[model samples]
Target: MTMHIDAGPRSSIALTGTEFAELDRLIFEDDDWWAMPSAEQAALRHRFITAAVAHHLEHNAAYRTFAESSGFTLADLGAPGSLVRVPQFPTRMFKRVEVRSVRAADCDVFKSSGTSGTQSMVWRDEPSLERLAGSLRPEGDIWRTLYGDVDLDDDGQMVHLGPNRREADGVWISYIMTLVEMFAATRSYVADGVLRLRDVVRDLEGALADGKFVCVAGPPVFMAELLRHMSDNGVKLSAGDRMAVITGGGWKKNESTKLDPDRLRSLAMDTFGLASAQQVRDVFNQVELNTAFIECEHHRKHVPPWVEVIVRDPRDLSPVPAGQVGLMSYLDPTARSYPCFLLAEDFGSAETDNCPCGRGGTTVHIDRRMRTSSHHGCALRLAETVRTD
Candidate 1:
């Protein structure tokens, strides 16, 4: 089903696997290599915002009120600065406010685990929600293609950490379940002896014995627990060439744990008998949208033009120079059902300089915006996840 329902208000606004293609082309395209041509890309970004404004005016109660007051209209809004003149409800308000796109019979919701030391609500239309669901397929299929075939059991054997399933019962429940299904599929490989980890290496060893690739992905703190276990057990996995350990969810704060990308890579290579960071890529993404950009070993994330990642000064929302670390603000021109102009809490700088890898365009060097803390002594920076008036 494109949409997954929960008992009540917690149901998800997710799309289906079959619908990912349409959404993919809408927001992201394979041709979006490097940065987008400024003029063309900006035009698309303008269209996305125009669509959201029109949608809000038509269906969203909160936006309708604001639009009416601001004299919002369907004119060619033509410019980025002009688009911002339109109101933006900081995403955080969803968790506390009653704002919605009309009192519909159906709405999708996905609530974060509050793991980021914050609580928030992520909403999406059915089609966008389906695209979010389809994202997992590409994410999983990429791993599967790299490692060979994997297996999974329908039974909930592998534990899903952070929050309970009931927690996924948010308005965007489909996105949450898509996350659940992804976990199930990934863990199935382990259950079927396809991948190994500190908690279930032996089960995954069966896959290794058969020459299949294995993958481990989760928050850093969660995986660190297993890495310590694997280290003590004298099980060195020189498997980086064939195995992958992708850690995301930023650094788990509110807890005194630390996992640096370099250190994490070192441990994976040492314990798992891996090779280089190239085999393990860190992904940058969010719950609101379906785009997932992978970072190169150099820690630079190459973004296509469809995705406009702007590094803004933390003190002021003005743009910052390239190569300088600052707050990450995004504009995804293709996003529908939701506003594409995203003011996120993620901290990182645009990679304005040329890369030895020959890939060019703007990219993010770091994103401490979502991070509560880090081991590196870089001056602390925080962007309001959502600053609602």
Candidate 2:
């Protein structure tokens, strides 16, 4: 495959279209239940990650420097051994550094909301973004296996408490992707710097009044405020209606309000009239990682086979035993712009044993993020604004 290499800051190292198509086929294989055996999946992932590492080492200068500094060689990655040798960079590094394997002109620069301080720039080539879009091919099948046809139900309404994609910068892509996949009528309460609380309440109450299912989604802080308002205003919803409230990101802005998961679940049941606690689908995701660790009915966050999770000692970043919470790090081969190995700021425990849900993958439990990490971002700023009003 022919490629253009530049000598300047925009030095490029990206997979060709053909290479990306092949890699994507392996990474995003359509398996609804992800029922592949642990041993087979591990073997496949090992090969994929090794190839991914080699690709980055050859193409990405920043990743090569980081790997060499960490005492990793391409030869070392060639062996069939523990993946622990691969170096994982901190998530905060993205905020301060610009690392990519592709030229700036060839990428779509996605910026964070800058809720805390400065916005982070994450570059993605068209191929990576297209792969990301294709990765969800199994999502519909997985949702069907878990929540049944409810995800495909066209009668439901999608209510987003955050800003629309156009107004949210690039940080709201995940939210917008979810909204689009719902394939139902949708509305955003906060968009273009406007907070239509009354309009949201009217739509929500009207939907419930007509015996229609409503899917409420957004940041926990915003959802908490909506639920609190619904409860205080005595807006009753039908328990018989199919309702689900999915919350993501952290509760940093609502930390002062003490947003308890149990309390929120109770509020969802009491005010929004959700039928089960499982309907409150909390997820563990970050701007750095594309895959989301969605909580199942048992509240266990299952790590898909495409990536591996490691809990490391916070002091020295050494791998800790199962059940011991520490730094949450991931090795994802699907990421192409930069090194897929990432050390997140959060602390979480990992269980490799099979879950009761019959899915045999790494199950993670994130305790919380390290307090020392940076907090400036668009979501935090939006949360602060929403909370103040």
Candidate 3:
């Protein structure tokens, strides 16, 4: 595999984790996750109001019916936060309408994974992808700081473990890889890694042996297989090499639906080797976006106020009081080229409540609804995190 190292740092405005934590505190303090001082964020909200009104008037038959019955016009939402009063377009809209603010050529892109013939969710990541992509850079510095700088032979290699070969809307992994490319040569799952799981580990062992050690990311099922393959091959990564096993998506049915970290590690211990797997951390992300909320050692998908989250009733679309599990949505005013505020079918709860993290924000708890079935998969969108850029 071949790659171009991104030098020491990508930008002058780069922030280490601590600096980002401070910035996150400053910018994200109260109810300002999507409320940035930038004119760009405000403009995007205005554009959304206009587009939503137009949709209500023209294409959105369901919205038009709702508006006509309620005496709400397409122009009713000219003010920000007005959409909150109206019933959200049902999560089923994706299966029925091309519910986009702009044309494919005009707006940013996101895609959805096809459930087992039941639901169609938008997995669009193109919008706000740059914001999410930039978020990962600060994390790179976190790695450099937490684990002292590791010397690489320059042309390092990696084995990525997810649905990245084709663009099927796995946005979180896409940004994760983009962040990783800054440090090493990335060997793709489709292009270079083996079609057979064991063979992939053999290739990784070979890369590490050749002094081109790499990083890896994937779902627990696939990653476990590869880790086992590595164990069978008697492989071990060096100190300079890094790997983070991400619990980015929903659980695999007919398998374990539990989220116990110890059980997850125990299942893959013999294969990936627990010591090596310890480096495999969890990154939280949303398939619909570019900015990812990462996980700390506590397994929490931490968020700053820049990425706004809204938990509402799936039946009528009202923001549920904190601590109640509801359908999760996001408002990313930072994304300029596409729709900034997006309502998704993600299931989680919000907490205005305090946290032990020394930050003032909410911690999301995933309820595994999307993976349940098409009907329930349309229930809520659980935001996943970083790796794709």
- TM-score per candidate, chains pooled: 0.69, 0.87, 0.62
**Which candidate leads the pack in lDDT?**
2
Question: Candidate 1, overall lDDT?
Answer: 0.50
How far residue 375's Cα lies from its native spot in candidate 3, in Å, is 7.8
Please, what is the whole-model Cα lDDT of each candidate in the order they appear?
0.50, 0.67, 0.47
C-alpha RMSD (angstroms) for model 2: 4.2
lDDT, candidate 3, 223-279, per-residue tens: 555655566667655433243344444443333443455566555544443344445
Q: lDDT rank, highest first?
A: 2, 1, 3
Better of 1 and 3 by TM-score: 1
The backbone clash count of each candidate, in order, is 34, 9, 35
Q: Rank the candidates by TM-score, best first.
A: 2, 1, 3
Tens-digit per-residue lDDT, 109-193, candidate 1: 5555443434445455565555454444433333343334434433212322222334324513212322544534444222221
Q: lDDT score, residue 53, model 1? A: 56
Candidate 2 structure quality by residue, lDDT tens digits, 114-210: 5444455666776656555554442544444334565435566778877776766677433433543434677777855655666778888788776
lDDT of 3 at 233: 61
